[model samples]
Target: MCSGGFAKCLGVSLMPLAVVCVLCNILLFFPGGTTVDSEHITQQVWYFGGILGSGVLMIFPALVFLGLKNNDCCGCCGNESCGRRFAMLSSILFAGVGVMGAGYSVVVSAVAINHGPQCLTKNGTVMKWTYPFSEGDYLRDHSSWSVCLEPAGVVSWHLSLFSVLLVMGIIQMALCAVQVVNGLLGAICGDCCGCCGEVSM
Candidate 1:
């Protein structure tokens, strides 16, 4: 397939993943699918890893890739070949942005997972919002989840959603990395395999 077409496919795939990441981040705000005080919510949810890093940043590159296939400059520059090559070359920058954004999400998600969720916990006579589990201590032992006294089932909710963000971020990074190479190939090879016929005319 042509580089532009491949990029278009990558763009299409990224759109839904970005949406999913945004939704996952939003859900993180309401742990256990119930409303809670904003102060009680996990700190990483405030970082906007899925919303800003993966969702908004990724959309720019996806839109750029989607438009690459139809890019034409015959009327503007009287040189469709040069215009197409320039567009492809520019796409590499957007892909780098995507890579960085996704990487940010991955780092935040990993840290959140390690820290566990913020919830009301009983410390002697007082109930306070705190991280009840040590780094990754609760993941292996379901019984340890009882330490979080309020925001019922928050431990499971936190682990599941953050895990999704981590996996999705990794996938987004890989896709953007692939686009960097695809953009380079399109720049060098003139965007499409059959463009030689049009150039000859």
Candidate 2:
């Protein structure tokens, strides 16, 4: 594929991940859609932003990485191909950070999207799963039990979008690790399919 075409293809793959991250962030506000009290605490919203927004931002590097990687590889400095080498190295770093950030973001997304719907108050004690409090304040203050109930009275569990993203992050991290190793150690795989195409993972 041509460099520009390959880049466009990568962009297409990255778009869905970005959308999912965004939707999850939006859901972070509601938890169960229309039930959360937005005025309750600033920290609650902040945490939500941290997780969901952070996750989506993780894909930002995909653009830089793909563009840089599309250039020719240079084993020697000043070979002009070195620019692609620099890009490859930059991608490994950027993708590495993205992987970690994604772990946190996915975990937040999973809970916000999948787990925040089933909440209920049992007797005087509100069900435990829903943690809309930002912090674990509910665990210590039984008096705040009312806050536990969604306006609709449902308790949700802790399921995070991280389950899937975490796995993807791990896989990418491993691949990048291989790239980094190859870069630093100058290991060759006795194979050819074009330079960067020799993906270790």
**Alpha-carbon deviation at 29 in model 2, angstroms:** 1.4
Model 2 over residues 1-201: C-alpha lDDT tens digits? 333234335444555665665554455455444544655322234454343444455566556545643433423323433344444445456655655665565455444433233343454544543335434444355465455554432223222433334344444345334434433332232112244444433
Give the runs in model 1 whose Cα sits over 4 Å from its true position: 72-81, 197-201
Candidate 2 positional error at 137, Å: 19
Per-residue lDDT over 93-174 for candidate 1, one digit per residue giving the tens place of the 0 to 100 score: 9999999999999999999999999999998999899988777888889998999988998998999999999999999999
**For model 1, what is the error of residue 193's alpha carbon versus the real structure, in angstroms, after optimal superposition?**
2.8
Candidate number achieving the greatest lDDT relative to the actual structure: 1
In order, candidate lDDTs are 0.90, 0.43
Error of 1 at 173 (Å): 0.5
